[model samples]
Every structure is written in C-alpha cells, then in structure tokens.
Target: MSRPRRFLPSVSLLTAFEAVLRTGSTAAAARELDLTQGAVSRLVQNLESQLGQPLFLRERRRLIPTEAARAYGRDISRALDLVARASMELAANPGGGVLSLAILPAFGTRWLAPRLAGFLSAHPGITINLATRLKRFNFAAEGFDAAIHFGVDDWRGAGHLRLFDETLVACAAPAFLRANPIRQPADVHALPLLQIETRPTAWPEWFRAHGLVAPLPRGMLFDQFAPMTQAAIHGLGVALLPEFLAMPDLDEGRLQRLPGAPVSGTGSYWLVWPEARADYPPVVALRDWLAAETADLRAREGAGDGADDGDRTRTP
Candidate 1:
C-alpha cells in the first residue's frame, strides 16, 4: 500500500523544512539550501499549508519550531542521513558488489583484517566495507549486509555461520605478575581483575570453570578488549583476554600468562546476515570462506583437544 500523499511530503519541502528547523531561521536555511530567504520561507509555509498545521511560531521576525515540528525534524534528519549514505554507497559502487560488514573491534583488527586480502584477491569485483559494532544492531536500520557477532547463535531473524569458539587466557603484565604472583586458581580473585563492559560475567565464569566459587572484586572497566589488554600490559590489573588477542603480547614477553589453564568463554563467534540477504553473493562468499578458514579450529574444538592447555595456539 502506498503512504498517504499528505504524510509523504516532497523531498524538497521536507529538506527545506528540516533546514529551517535545524538552522533556526529562513536566512540560515537559505544559505544552507542555496535558496533565497523568501524562497525558503515560502517552502516552509507551503509545507505547513499542505499539512494543514502550523510548524513554527513567528515571534518578532523569529521562527521557533513547535514541539511537534522539532520531533518530526529529528526523524527527518535521520531519514535524510540514511538517504545520503545510500546515495554515496551507490555512487561509489556503481557495479553493485558492495558488502557493508560490521565487526568487533579487536576481532576485526587482530583476526579478520589480516585475512581479508585473500578474500578481496579472489573476488576482485566485490568491495568489502567494514565498520566496528561492539554489540548487536538492527541490520535494516544500520544498512549492513552482514556482521561479525561474538556470542551464542541467537540473533533473531538472521542466518548464522559458525566461526569459532573463544578461549580466554588470564594474563597480566610481567612486572605485575612478579609483584603479585598467582600460585593457584583462587589467587586470581585476590588481585585486581580488569573487566570488559560487554562481558560482565567473564571473570566469574572463568573462576567457575576452574572450580573456584567466590565473589569477584570490582576492578577497572573497559568498553573494548584493545584498551583492556593495554591496561593489563601497563600493570593496571589482571585481565582475562581472548587467546587470539593475548597471543602476540604473550609471545613478545610483554605479558605473562597467569597461573591457570585457558578456559572456554561463554559464547562463540559467528558471521550473521539478515534472512533477506541469505542468497546475496558477497554474504555467501564470506560465509563459505569463513567456514573453510575456521574448519581446522572448529574440528579441534569439537574433538575436545587441549581443553585446559595454556600453551596451545589458537587462531581467530
């Protein structure tokens, strides 16, 4: 069904009204829209006449938007931004093989970025645009073709491709570990434990996995793993980092593994796409590539090998 004509005003009228609402005056809106002040005023007046409602209050030659108009302007602004982004994407990729993918910060930089070259080389015609999304988002609203999701396979209305399970290693700066040595599994609780905002239960689950049952202490909170890993390297606190993320630091001797075995994290990683794009060429290519890429790791995990080995190497 088509939208009511009155509710769906012309883009020009909406742009003019939005500009006036944003710029505070017809003169400023005129400057922004590259129209005469009189023309801009006429546009807003025309919109008001079409809608049969007053959008602005004329007070001493000043235009003050009504509350309803302000609210409407906010929605219009978002819509305009979405339209502009879509336009730009189309302009940039006229041939139409653009894949806008959202990724986790650490995983994208440490894991996927290094391996993207092979995918790009194989599919030279496809362009992959990556954006960092630390948490779940609406695919339709966000305008993403797919996203790297780190959790259980529970994203509603989306298709999932298993990547790999995450293994967490408790690590700290070498100096900090020397100063506060960890001799047992319970010793981790005695020290300041860094926390990731998204994984609030990580420390507790790690402790539980090691057969330790104690209330965890509050410590430094970080929104992402990159900074938390840096904080741990700087002797701020002991952090439970993903094995893939902590491997370089441990290998370079910047951080030492705390006295414990690597524990399985709460969830696994997945490549998720909306159901509508289930057959999208780029999504299918990426899904197949990821499945093939992580086949060995997934097999190892399935076979239950190295369940408690801290020295085992794992790739993301």
Candidate 2:
C-alpha cells in the first residue's frame, strides 16, 4: 500500500537489481544495459542497502541471487515492461498519444477496417494501432488501451460498452448447396458442417431453435470467420456464417444462404477497456466512434437495408 519511491531507492538501482537477477551476472547485466560491471554491481549494492537486506550470496567468484532478490525481480519485470511500452508509445508519437487496441480478426477486417477511415479522419492527433486477438487478454499486461470483445458483458475487471448483437446465417458456395440440396433443417446434419471453434454449439443451437433436434455434425474446424467463410466459398462445406460477412459473396453470387431463417446469436460485441481507464481520452474517442458506427448500422438495418447483411462481426 506504500509508494515505491517511499523506500528512497533510485529506479536505476532496481533496474540493476532486476538485470543482474535475470542475467545471473553483473558483467552480463552491464553488457545488456551498456554500463560497466562495477557500476552495475554498485547499483545493486545501493539497492540492497536501501532495502536493508542481503540480495545475493557471494561464493568466491560466483554471485547467486537470494530468494528475496528473485521475488523483487519478478515484481519489477512487469513494471519495467509497462515503462518500456509507455516510453515506446511516447517516442513513436511525440505530439500526441497512441491507442493500442486488441481486436477480433474477422470483425476487425470485415467490419472495423472498412469503417476505420472515419475515425482516423476525425482524430488526427491520436495514432491507432490494432492487433488481432483470438481470446481475452489482460489489458494491463498486454498494453492495450481497449479491445473489441465479442461476448456477453462479462469481461472481468473491465468497463463494457455494448456495440451490437451478432446475427448468423447458414450459407455456403452456391455450387456446393446446389450439388447437395437442402430441403429441411435436418438436411444440414448430412452436409459437411463447417464449425467455428469458439462457438462449438452454434450449429446444434441453431438446429434446436429451428425445431430440429439431432447430434452435432462434426466437420472441418476453423478458428476464425475469415477462413471459415473462405473455406465455404471454396465449396468445402456448409458454413454457419455471419450475414454481414456473407453479404458480399451472396450479392455477388459467390455464396448462397440455406433455407433456415436468420438466427440471433447468444452474445453481443462490446468495446471493453480497463475500468480504471474509463476516462482516458483516446479510449473515450474510440468508444464514442464505435457507438455511433454501430448505431448507424442498426438504423440502416432497421430501415430495411436489405442489400447487405446487418453487421456481421464476430470475435475468434
């Protein structure tokens, strides 16, 4: 509960301690930090004196870190990573700040990427960096300002801003569907059912919703919607795809929707960030932009924008 500076130890002291602990030698630490071995050793000594504890056991020519030193190194490593990332961001954009985001692959490419130009145009000062994340990650550890999360509002230790619910449709390449005609919902069980790895029960749940009960058909597994949709386009099998993703193909006659009605997915996409950073400027800007974007999408869908599938974005 006490501040780190209350101990009166310099950051250099802690840095030296961490480096020596990790590299297992003052000479190695010095080489890594571009400092002399003597200076590195002196920094470690200063830290030990400040803490009033023996950090290492010296055996003739060898120095072995004590348990306390190892524990301290572990704690400071994460803090050092945070400092390094922050410094890198500041250096990369000297005029302003960077909003490093973790995004779902398919949603980012198909939905967000196409709509991102508006946000960039609106916020000229902030640099937005995006990386695809297939699963939930710790924002603090991962150095992400926010994430495009697709699920219920259950991201632990985070603030959630609801984006929109996902809508799924059964579709495949027209050639595949034509070759294996589907007259009823039960017909899907016989087809090569392409499965989304994250939503293992989606096919079965869709069938159950359609009043058709059967064992889940096993088939080719895809981790993300992009490849799954591509596989379907190549006539690999029937894919349960998001309408938005399938819209371009369907409209261009590349893919065809099966007979079942559009199925509402169980989860919603959300803009999630560390609750502590709810007031961060860059995060606020992104969240506001996404709010407006999804609103426009829903409005268009409500207005019977029948040409395209209503936003079909999904997380891995």
Candidate 3:
C-alpha cells in the first residue's frame, strides 16, 4: 500500500520548495529555514531534478513558481502542517490519546464545559483539546477529531450523534421589560430586538409561531450569543436565546421572559465526526459519554416535556 519512491519527496526538499514558493525568493526561504541562500537553491534544484521538471521560471534575478508548481505547493503546505501538528501532539501527550474538538462558543462554555470534567475523570488516559468554531470546516484540512454542530444532520461524509434540540425563549432585561411592557407577542416589535448572526430568521420564525407574521425591524446584530446575552442584561434589547443560556440570567432576575411561550429553534445540537474517524477510540469514548449525558434531555424532548402549550407541536 506504500506509494512509489519517486512520488514521495523528502521532508527537506518539500520544506525548501514550499518555503521558496511561499516567500517568493531563495534568500527569504534561507532566512526562514536558517540555511544559506546557496543551500536553499541547491535543495530546490535537487527537488526539480528528482521530479524531472522545472518548478520555477527564472527571470533576471527573480524566481517565479509555475502554475503547476503553485498548485503542488498548496498540497505540500497542507501536508507539512499536518506533519507538524502530529509531531507536536505526539510530543505533548507521549503515551496518552488526544482528541482535538471544535465547539460552538456559547454551547461549549455553558453546556459542555461544565460536564467535561466527568468525561475526563472517566477516561483519564484521553486528553481533549477544544477550539471555538462557529461554522463548518474541512475536517481533513483542520485536523479535528470531532466537532459540536448546531444544525440539521447535513454534514456530508460525517457521522452524527444527536445531542439535544434547543428551546428558545424571547427575553429582555428586567428593567427594559418594566419600561416597555410586553402585553402581547406583537409588542416585541415596539422595542429594539437583538439578533444572533447564526440565526438570521429567528425573530421572524418566533413571530410566525405566535401568529404574528410580518417583516421585523432590524436591530443590533451579534456574531455570538455570549455578547448578545450580555447586551440583553444591560437593557440593550430583547434577545431570543436558548433556554439553557437564558435560565441562569432569568433566575437571577437579570432578564425576564417576554410574554410568549418558548419555541423550538431551527436546529438541534449534534456531535459530529468525519466518517473516517467513526471508530477512533477517543471519538468513540466521547460519543458514548455524550449519549449518556444527554439521555435525560432526549427523554424529555421525546415526551414533549421541553415544549410549551403554544408551539409545542412544531418541529425544529
């Protein structure tokens, strides 16, 4: 199953070629690699000899990479990054397993972070590293073992495990609500409305669920829920927030639920991994742990416990 010897370039040759292509000169590549200019030029020449083609076009004193060489450099750069990441991980965790997970910011901080200790306690040999990623990414290029996805199960070539559906509550600061009382669902439009960037149609959808269908006024737009939640706490505007995110603030009297029933958001939470990593040991362990952790929420959702009287029947 090994590739032909000619197809596999040495790391030194690849590094030199990639550096020259990226830096646009052998002098710059030499500075980066801490090698003399002549040494770097030699490495490039050796690589070209091995490949049986000229990768660069010499004009005056400049070296311009050919179009084909530019494309090949892109692949080489990715391969080098992968190798570096692997080397770093191996050095950091020597004998232990490492799982690099991409997570949604609010969900990671409010939900998963609190319960992660239990998972780590159960599997002491596994180390989980988390990074915030708000949108989908190329798994092969990013080098993540798994990601926390908040949407429909539509990640092609990835295996999904349902976590839980989110229930959204329209809420505002207690002072703001007292200042502009919400007597009905339509009253929400009278005040400033905050919107999360990820959920563009949330306000419209929430209004439609309450039998009030019309174009909504644009308000402040936030990229993440954390800042939006804080803005609502400071009486900036009413925000549609997930119940889990809003519960603590509501209980502490920082925010008050608007005069409307809770409605299901347009998406559900999921633990997704590339199909190639479906059976990875760390991934499998985390999947099993998440399934157990979300069992209660799943049960409540199935029994209609998470729904309200008004929009309980609507699917997420």
CA-lDDT, candidates in order: 0.86, 0.83, 0.89
Model 2 C-alpha lDDT per residue in residues 129-235, reported as the tens digit of each score: 99999999877778788999887767787877777777889998988988998887888888888988888778877888899885656779989998898999999
lDDT for model 3, on a 0 to 1 scale? 0.89
Off by over 4 Å in 2: 1-4, 298-316
- Give the worst 10-residue stretch by lDDT in candidate 3: 307-316
| Candidate 1 structure lDDT | 0.86
Off by over 4 Å in 1: 1-6, 275-280, 303-316
CA RMSD, predictions in order:
5.9, 5.1, 4.9
Better model by lDDT: candidate 2 vs candidate 3: 3
Per-residue lDDT of model 3, residues 125-156, tens digit only: 88899999999999988999999999877787
Error at 177, model 3, angstroms: 1.0
TM-score of 2: 0.88
Question: Candidate 1, residues 46-138: lDDT per residue as tens digits?
Answer: 999999999999999999999999998988888888788778877887774788899999999889998999998987878899999998998
lDDT of 2: 0.83
